[model samples]
Target: MENQSKKVTLFTPVKLGKFELAHRIVLPPLTRMRTVNGFIPNDWMVEYYSQRATKGGFLVTEGTVINETGHGYYGAPGIYTDEQVAGWKKVTAAVHEKGGIIFNQLFHVGRQSHRSLQPNGAEPIGASAIPHEDLVFTQQGWVPAEPNRALETAEVKALVKDYHQAALRAMEAGFDGVELHGANGYLIDQFLQDGTNHRTDAYGGSMENRVRLMIEVLEAMVDVWGSDAVGIRLGPSGTFNSMSDSDPIALFGYAAERLNELDLAYLHLIEPRINGNIEIADGLEPVASMHLRGIFKNKMIAAGGFDQAKAEDILEKGYADMVAFGRHFIANPDLVFRFKNGIPLASYDRETFYGGNEKGYTDYAFYEAYADA
Candidate 1:
């Protein structure tokens, strides 16, 4: 029992870009489809995030699409609309009021969308027209996603501009910073993965060429928010959205080494699993995210399947600077307090994880407050 209690040596301050984090705990981006139609933030979102503003590191909002054409799933937040920006401002304001730092994750789903979510029924856009066999959640139901029309060489430049504009809107909306949503087989990740990006252009083929779009998006965002206020998320081995790559080490290793030069705020990497299922891999192959720790010189945060003991060991071994947990924070809004006091976490109900009223969203009780009530 004594050894178990002393196993975790987790409580330590860390510097995340310009902000000094009080703890090495983070709230990774967890997409909860609770926004209004047209993807605007709402008062419920403000309260939802404010409730999770405990003493852990920082909280990143779920992926908020950059433009209307970038929209892929229904009820996700957006940064392209003035109304959406104003709505997010309320959320950011609430987080700040609670003495917590928050960042808006700018995203675009690309080929992972339906025609109904696009502009004038336009097909989703990707680096290539290769159709993926994944389903997109829509108002009707989960349906096979449409193949995206490949972006013309010139049109790709316009999409980068959308990321830049979204960065500007994030600042105007009172966010501490903007994190580029480059992970989870989204548009940016699609461009980075060789399996999906089979174009014979400057933005494909070789590793440098394949990473051009992501680098360009980073450059564009830096122009608006500066490097200090920007970060990126990468899921090199994530199989979510039916994603696969022949060689993720070659693909992501080259990317991590190259991105070290940017010196962005923090590089968030998702720990890989077999087909999005978090089971121990049978083989001892070096994990995609573990390799990134040495390659990326900036602050690094690791997410997926992180518990207190594991996070403490990883931190002690210098494998990661911070640890992010999504579902844990969802069930225990006062996660930091619970960890400090060694209180049990509230069990999360899977039934209300997605779209719903306040039952599972804002009604989760805090340890101290809920016990008192």
Candidate 2:
């Protein structure tokens, strides 16, 4: 047992913001569409999280829409309504019961959303009127992304207010902290990327103007949660939802420097490899994480198709303070233990990953249980 424990570097404890994690293995935000109608977290969702909340480990909830208009995918949870906040309380209580730390990932789909999911069938909004040619999964099945209208300068303040109010609700829901979904070509990413944001306003054009909205939202969230209790996720080179920056090195390097000024809890960076897995763009260099590693003067998290060896290497080299696991955690509720003991992970069925009941969600057997059987 001692030998097993000593072999894994991921078992080491670290402090993230106000919470101290027992280990570096994090359950990153995954969009599992299993919430009840009206977008409330249900008992099933509570069980799902409780089963995976390793003692002293960190877990971030699925990408939860911040408001009604932020809804895009079916079954994703929301943090806007009183009922939704109350529903999430159960989830937070369960995780806390297991001595686990959880964060709510506040999300806004922006131009990536379909009109049917928008407020009163209204057109989706973005930094500009640019329409994403990609398709988004909705209740009616996959459909073409609706052309989005540019947010009026006045409306931008309201959008920031939405993020602020959502963070407040997250606190009421008992989350340890909140992570702004500034990655994955969502609303925040739309504003951050030049291809998606082409307006000649205060929010677009130069790299400084492009990063303004994200910084404003981060500042607003900081007002509610304090700098230590807030975190931001950035995909400096991610191409998901067809996102790309003209010069990721300059844009994200600046963003990291700016975010450092806020003293954020951590900067969760999606490695270029993970973003490339979704869409491999030629000449796309994976240097943002490495470059920002030197710039961001805070805890850094590196996530993307990482295995045990790679995670250990990154941590040992000080590339990241923590390593977040997605697919590995999905199929192994006792993932931390498995990694510590060198147990093989059960393969997950991709078909049942989203919009499903408990079959593929909580039914994955634990290491002990599977071995005993």
Candidate 3:
């Protein structure tokens, strides 16, 4: 027992803020479009989250928009409305019933949104008037992204309030914590990267100016949930959504230093190889976590294309405190049990991943039934 105590495995317990996590396998936010009216969590979502929840395990909901203007894709969940908060209560209750800790990921997908998805059919807002370089999924099907207008100086400040309000709503809905969706090419990332942010205002220019919006937004949420219950995700090396920076190491390193001030619950970093859901060239060694780990003092989570061996390796080396599995969790409801018992994960069907029913959402059986079959 003394020899085993020295080893840090996926099942090892760790304290994240005030909660004692039973295991280090975290369920990061995934954009599964299974919500109902007004992008509200439905009964299916309750079942979906409950299936994945285990006693003392951690789970984060899909990227849930904070307000009406935050929508980007069709059917993504939101928490800005009274009805939406009530809907989310069912989801949080389900996870808690299984003794799992769940956090809601507050999101706003900037230029990645379309005019049709925007409130009053207005142009989506971003750091600048930069048009998205790729297609965005909308109710009209996959269509070329419409150009976004630069957010007015006043509007940018108002967004910090939006994040705070959303954090409050998350608390009301019975969530243990909330994570800001600052990663990928969302509203926060648009301001953080120099390539997209060409503004001369206080919100843009140098690295300090570019990172202001993210910092303000984090502070706003921290005010509502406190730093201990709030976390942030950052994809410093992610180029998805046409995101680019002159120098990622310096940019993210500086951001990490700033994040230390908040003393956030954890800083989730995506691997350089992960471009959203797909994996790109992985010839490079683990860079983002390796560097940011030295800067960010709190627990760190490293995600993207990680298997059992790779996940364990980083944990053992003290590079990351946890590993988030997306595709595997989508296929294996009892992922913790499977990993503990050496059960092979079931293959996931990509076709049914988005905008789907029970086929890929909650029908993935538990390992006990799976083995019996």
Candidate 4:
């Protein structure tokens, strides 16, 4: 009876590396593409982040591009420029004002881009010159991703430097920590998975060479912010942006075990149920977090398709220390409070998920428990 009654509570406090949260719920990065011209965060972005902030809660900002050529969509925020850094300062301040811990999720979209989004119309750089019909949203509307050139050995090193500089700028922007976007078939994922990485160079042709870029990038980030302040997000079975791996379990297991040496903030895992940002019915591929929990052996945050019951269950079973809600947080600004108080959540409108003003962005209301009293 005692063992059966030992129900885990999401309202309880949990320590995640350098920070201690009042609750176990986390707001993961969600790219809404609502930044201003030149990919700068505006007042609307400030209010949006501020609205979601809670005392001692955690918020991971959307995948802020590290460089211009690394961008895959227009209006997606960047942290590379001085002006962009200034824009993010406002955002970080807003979240901090609410006493919320925030991290900048820095990334490069890799081959998930078109020539139009590149510098001087140069082909987007990736692990290799792989091309596919994975649509990247551009100024001209949804178009198939264009051919990308393989990054030379020297160019790969330069991109690691880019990540280091971006980490510095993120700290300058007043973010509490940083999460390297190594998932979702982005630059890092393109290097890790065999489907996208077809290079015979030192950066590929073997799992060590393939994972080297991501490991080096994380090492660079740790140099800026201590190991305790850095986190990594990975998706083992995620096929988003045409991603695949011949041996996901072996590849991801080795990567997770390697990550344990860093003693980083957390390993945020995206479930195989999630394809990119949306939930999908994937045939029995196994949950990525379940497969990786024991191997990573550090703080882990499981994301993708989690609700109140599911989130509590994961914590009870010790699969992840916290749960990240992207789509749910979009509709419920006071999501942490809702979870704490056992209140019903509002459903989100998928049509207004991307490239919108205040419709599905910041207009979500808080739960009114004592209305008409």
Best by lDDT: 3
Cα lDDT tens digits for candidate 2, 223-304: 9999988999888778888898888888889888899889999999887777523424434333555678889988888888
Task: Please count the clashing residue pairs in each candidate, in the order shown.
Answer: 0, 0, 0, 0
TM-score of 4: 0.95
**Tens-digit per-residue lDDT, 1-373, candidate 1:** 0123233355676667778768877877877778866688988898899988854359899999999888777888899989999999999888888878898899999899999988898888987888679987677756889988888888888998999899999999999888988887889988898778888988888889989999999998889877887889988778887677778888888888778778798888887743442435534332655687768888778777776766777776666777887778888888877776778888887777766567788888887554453
Question: Each prediction's Cα lDDT score?
Answer: 0.80, 0.86, 0.88, 0.87
Off by over 4 Å in 3: 1-5, 282-284, 369-373
Put down candidate 4 lDDT per residue, 1-373, tens digits, no spaces.
0122455567778787789899878889898999858999998899999988988998999999999889898779999999999999999999999999999999999988988889899888899887677888888777888888888899899999999999999999999999999999999999999999998988887888889998999999999999989999998888888898999899999989888888888999999898876779634333776778778877889888888878878777777778899999999998887776778889999988878688889888878862221
Query: For residue 169, what is the lDDT in candidate 2?
Result: 98
Per-prediction CA RMSD (Å): 3.7, 3.7, 2.4, 2.7
The per-residue C-alpha lDDT of model 1 at residue 160 equals 89
**What does the lDDT come to for candidate 2?**
0.86
TM-scores for the candidates? 0.93, 0.94, 0.96, 0.95
- Specify the poorest-scoring 10-residue window by lDDT in model 3: 1-10
Instruction: Residues 1-373, candidate 3: write the lDDT tens digits.
Output: 0123377889899888889999999988999888756898899999999988989999999999988888888889999999999999999999999999999999999888888888899988889997557777788767888888999999999989999999999999999999988888999999999889999999998999988998999998889888999889999878998999998889999999999999999998888888878878655556899999889999888888888888988888888888999989999888988998898889888888788667789898787754453
